[model samples]
Target chain A: MLRELADILQAEELCNTQGDNVQIDIACACDLMSDVLLHAKAQCLLLTGLTTTQSVYTAEVADIKVICFVRGKRPQRDVVELATNKNIILLATHLPMFESCGKLYRNGIKGCSEV
Target chain B: MSEDTTAQVLTAGRVQELVYELKIEDAMVRDVQTVNVESTMDDVRAILREQKISGTPVLCRGELVGIVSIEDLLKALAGGETKTLVREKMSPNVVTLYADEPLVHALNQFARYRYGRFPIIDRKTKKLVGILTKGDIVRCLLRRLEMNHQARERAHYRPGHLFEDVVSDKSTLVLRHRVEGSNFQRAGEASSRLKKNLLSLGLSPDTVRRIAIASYEAEMNIVIFTQGGELVATIEPNQVTIRASDKGPGIPDVELAMQPGYSTAPDWVRELGFGAGMGLPNIKKNTNEMSLDSKVGEGTNLRFTVYTTNPT
Candidate 1:
């Protein structure tokens, strides 16, 4: 069952982040944008804390649906604006990286098939 | 009217309240080392040498403070005398990451910032934990590619599957010879032929694009660089992959070969409007994935892949 992106973002406490309603199936959590670029996984949500235009570029290149910024650190205004323009979801939470990932995992968001 | 109002309200809500949960941390590296800002330059150099390290975090009173590197030491040495002081030369305001952050976050941070390494810290205690380097990220990426290749092989998808539509079962090993260094005016023969064959097979537009880009880049590299080489085009149902292995003098610096704005092509190649140094970059840009293996004085082999889903 597809859940509402806004619901997930709020539950994760990442609500002022960009991705709100975009659908994500699997999760591809990595700090390295290059791996995301080379890895082919569909409908995957990107979990990261990177705040840069390159993160947006990587999302565009890899076709990621959502970005979850961990550690409560928000993206720069330009980054959020870019996501808005691209229709890519951006979300952030205060949870540390491991806990954030675990929260999603417990909720049934698995990594991509190859992970 | 009520439904339209509801739609507008929902849309506005969507804009303000999007959330995301964390996923798996893709890459992890241990044994990252650090130095203290108060340490002497001698100590810094010794630490770097002992660890075989290029960059090190400088800590003060167990708090992340600055970074010191070979560049700093070299700069100090080049400017005047080698100052034994570490605090005087260390780079302040270090960019950092949390220990549990995802690799994608680190990748962006490194790429955008051009940082060689990041000090990983505990969020609450903010204690310095580990360091994530470019090497670690690249390692993760290479591992991912290898895993993907293994999976494809298990699925009976050899690299050659990219050209199955054009080559056919009876014509797999044949290499069509184009003129050696034949320029772009004569560039698209191999590509056009392959494209025609794919078009006849009713390949999707995305597939045709992959084949076209792969073949075009490979063909151009052959014509522009080598004394002469054959153009090989291969196709498969899901992927279009190209291998352009040439006997050109090869790349002196393989890393620079991949970098944009660095090219060894002749003036004539540029005059013909070809060598803008965009050949390899374009190949990399067009393909969904790529890899290069080259040895100086030996040869260069460029491997390019474009999926049917992503196009050429």
Candidate 2:
């Protein structure tokens, strides 16, 4: 499921390969850390356009372990380092937010709010 | 030792740790009742009666001289010396505690001296600061034990079960974290700590998430906009309250700042993914009650509360 999810997003691995085999059935797509905090469920994969260290912190607090930066946004070295330290998986894709969510949805990854 | 005896020893060890960790100032009563050394024994009796306390400290020219107990007053009355000065009847060899000393010292003093109360004094100035009784020590220990119990109950109990046996009239857990302004690396450290504490208290996942989000947003605002600030989360039985305050440049237009997409953040902040103008709006959306007050040149204060039950 993890490899399939990454393949669907056409994401490049940035850090923490240990979660590559973990199952991730839910994905939350958002750019704002605030929205992610408010709506993100635990263990969900976060797809965002923002590539800041705060993004990693938001995921850490929300219990999200994997993040795929959409819109081809590669986070700075510090951001990647923080995610690695927190054991969070990081990925990057050239697709925008809507397309990334669409591709993942088509591949059987459910949205966080879906039943 | 048997399993049961080991468990008893562990509990006793924890209590010992608490006494050493807690300071005398934490258990002492600050508003102490006192009597002037020149005051007559009759004056001490009236104070003990009005304050419903058994003893009062005697002071001379704003300096602690002795302690006058009800027994001292009774002796004065029986000997027909009710009009005698407290300086003559009160015990002059007073035993006092330093405010900064550990509570364990106070406990040892109580056991060794068999005294009813100890007047707490400033270590450097020798000025009386507070009064500590056995009752005060007990109350302080009980309150701390309750907090630790809730944290430990998470392992064996379901969410919300810790509150069922809470007998205290009011119990609150306060968590405070300092946020450094513009420190992107440590922006959400405060909120993360708050979330961890809330989870350990056996709160529902949904409630923890809401508080975490609201606090995270508030923390980000401080890092992005101001010099720095502090985030304090107070968890109560019915609600969780968060206060974020800073001494940075305050908002000039609160009404406009509340808008979903309004922001004054520099382009550099935007590039880091924050300052999306969604910070305040996101906080408002997640919290049940919210308020923000700011003085342009002074500071800003933001307070929000989230209810634990029947959230709408």
- TM-score of each model, in listed order: 0.32, 0.57
Residues B104-223, candidate 1: write the lDDT tens digits: 566557657776778787777887767777566545555665776787675454333444435455433233545456554345456656655665544665456545655665676677
lDDT of 2 by residue, B1-312 (tens): 543453344348677798889999999999999999999999998999999999999999999999999899889999999999999999998999999999888877876787889999999998999999978987888899898998677555653455656558877767789999988888887888888778767677778888888898899899988889899888788899999999969999999999988989898887776677888888898889999999998899999999896211
lDDT of 2 at A63: 82
- The DockQ-based CAPRI class assigned to model 2 is acceptable
lDDT of each: 0.62, 0.86
Candidate 2 residues A4-103, lDDT tens each?
8778989888997475578898999987676676667888999988887888889987889899998887888988998887788998999999999898
Kept native contacts, fraction for each prediction: 0.00, 0.68
User: What clash pairs does model 2 have?
Assistant: none
State candidate 1's TM-score. 0.32
Q: Per-residue error at A25 for model 2, in Å?
A: 3.4
Which consecutive 10 residues in model 2 chain A have the weakest lDDT in total? Answer: A31-40
Among all windows of ten consecutive residues in candidate 1 chain A, which has the lowest summed lDDT? Answer: A11-20
